[model samples]
Target: MIHFEISSYNPVLLTNSPLNIGVVETTLDALGERLLVIDRRGKVITQRLVPANNKLAIIVPFEYTVNNNLMCILLDDDAEKDGELVDNVKAAVIDMKNYTPPV
Candidate 1:
C-alpha cells in the first residue's frame, strides 16, 4: 500500500517516485484541511497581496512529461490576497518518496 507521511511542521514532503494521480487524489482527500503548508519555521507566512479570479490552483509541467509534473496550492487565509503565498504551500510528495533535487 502507498503511504503518504504528512506533517504540519514539515512544509515539504516527497515520495520516492511519482505517485499515481489517483493515489494522490485519495491521499489528498484523506488529508482534509491538513494539506496546507507552512514555512520551515512552522510559521504561517502571509504571501499574497492582490486579487484573483475563481481559479484557485496551480499545475507546473516540464520536460514533456505529465506524470512527473507536480501540482500544488498556494493559499492565502485572508479575504484579500492574490498570487501564490510562496513558502506557504504544500507539494504532492511524501517523506519516504522525497529526494534531494540536483542543483
Candidate 2:
C-alpha cells in the first residue's frame, strides 16, 4: 500500500475560497474514510487506513523512480467530471516494491 500525508497536498492552482478539506495530519485518517485510486490498467491501488474529501482526488499522470524500478502510477480513470469520486489519486506515491496484481 502507498502512504501519504494530507499535509503534503500541493494545490495545482490558486483559489480564493478556503479548502474544504481540513488541514491536519490526521484528517486523512478518520474512520469511515473510503478513498481509492485505480491505475490505467484497472488495478486498485491500495492504501492503509487513510482518507480524504468529496473530490475525486486524482493525480495527473507523472513519473517517479523507486528503488530503480522506474515505474509509473496515478492511473487515469477518465472520469466524466473532476472531483466526482474518490478514485485514482489516493496516494501521492505508490510503492510498487511488492505489488503483485491479482490473477
Per-candidate TM-scores read 0.19, 0.22
Expressed as tens digits, the lDDT of each residue in 11-95 for candidate 1 is 5755445542211221222112223323344443222222222322222122213233223334444424442423323333323
RMSD of 2: 18.8
Q: Find the candidate with the highest TM-score and give its number.
A: 2
Clashing pairs in 1: 14-94, 14-97, 14-98, 15-94, 15-97, 15-98, 16-97, 50-82
| Ten-residue region with minimum lDDT total, candidate 2 | 20-29
User: How many clashes in each candidate?
Assistant: 8, 2
lDDT of each: 0.31, 0.32
Best by lDDT: 2
The runs of at least 3 residues in candidate 2 whose Cα sits more than 4 Å from the true structure, single-residue gaps closed, are: 1-31, 51-84, 87-103
lDDT of 1: 0.31
